[model samples]
Target: MKHLRFYFDVISPFAWLAFAKLPKVIEGHSVTVDYQPVLFAGLLSHWGQKGPAEIEPKRAWTFRHVYWQAHRDGVPLQTPAQHPFNPLALLRLAMACAPEGMTPGRHACEKIFRHVWEGGGDANDPARLQALTQALAPGRDPNSDAVKQALKASTDQAIARGVFGVPTVELDGRLFWGVDALDMVSASLRGDPWFDGPDWSRAAVAPPGVVRPPKGNP
Candidate 1:
């Protein structure tokens, strides 16, 4: 079976928007997706990069772009007043629902995605997250023992993967960095260009390095 690896963080609006179409994309090509929750802060730290606070303009532009892209994808989304610093709890909740047997997991993820991206809800808020989860899984209460167990399992799985960012899709030991690259993932599942390098990196023969005359070439 085709496996599409997905990496994401709850705080990433772009990731939230991309999650909306994952199911549809997978079904379109009859493949399965493996979700990988990551820590955005940790990743940035590793890169020695100060967070978005260091670049307010860039952050604003990113949020705006995410909204526009979400619109293009027909996925409704909005920016939150503040992003959750840690979303492992939410990721665990998502993990519990993503497996084949529990269709509820998928529904729960969608609900949370909407809560974060559309309603501007804080994913780190247990009350809000649990509320959304309950709304989506009427039969299995988010506060139930079963759900707790599932959430724990999901969290464990995520930690095991060394996830440290949002929207990191991996396959064959290679990581695809963002939601915008889903088209490539979809193509892989379709048995086309599965191993081909990313579209952005494909080099069109860098027009033979040109050498100019010393000074006055008119």
Candidate 2:
């Protein structure tokens, strides 16, 4: 059996999009998707990651690329608010639902992702997160005792792992960042050529300090 560690910030639209498709993509593998909820900005600061919107050329191309991908996948692609609040509460609720195991974890994460991106609901809004929580677990509000306790546990685990970002997949002692890396994660699971070392992994390599090629220069 193989383990796939997934660290993601729920507020990321790209993460939401990736999460939506991941289940199907990994259906054939004997893998466990471990969800690690973390702070996106913190992770970015640590790894020096910048959102496409932060760079003009990157932002323009990314908009078209994301929309086209979403369209191809038949998923809605919305321009989420700049710095769409942190996903802390959202992570807490997901943790609450998964106290025992991932059966509930996947379900919980799915609901949260849908509410935030698909439904365009405000996850940072206490009322909204609570309402959605109630919808999933009868009479259990996000602010309730049960939810709060579970959230604490999840947060503790995150701190232990030194996690602070979304769509961060940890495997083989390596951390793969971003939703776009899912393919590589999947390929690694299947012992694909790239994971074996040439095709997939090296294709994404950039010269040191290349900075994503300043967008259009690629």
| Cα-based lDDT for every prediction | 0.62, 0.67
lDDT of 2: 0.67
Query: Highest lDDT among the candidates is held by which one?
Result: 2
RMSD value for candidate 1: 8.7
What TM-score would each prediction reach against the true structure?
A: 0.66, 0.70
Candidate 2 clashes between residue pairs 3 or more apart in a chain or in different chains: 7-167, 7-168, 8-166, 8-167, 9-166
lDDT of 1 by residue, 1-218 (tens): 65566766677877886788677667756556655554566576654566654588877788778778877888877666565356655655665555433433445666666766776656567688667656654554444566556655544444456544567666655555568777766666676763665653455356768866755675
Off by over 4 Å in 1: 95-104, 122-126, 133-164, 193-218
1-218 in candidate 2: lDDT tens per residue? 77777766677777777887788767888888777666565556655678555788887886688678889898875664434466667766676565443324677777777777764445577688668878777334455676666555555555467665566677775566666878777777777665566654576676677346554585
Error of 1 at 113 (Å): 1.6
lDDT of 1: 0.62
CA-RMSD of model 2: 6.0
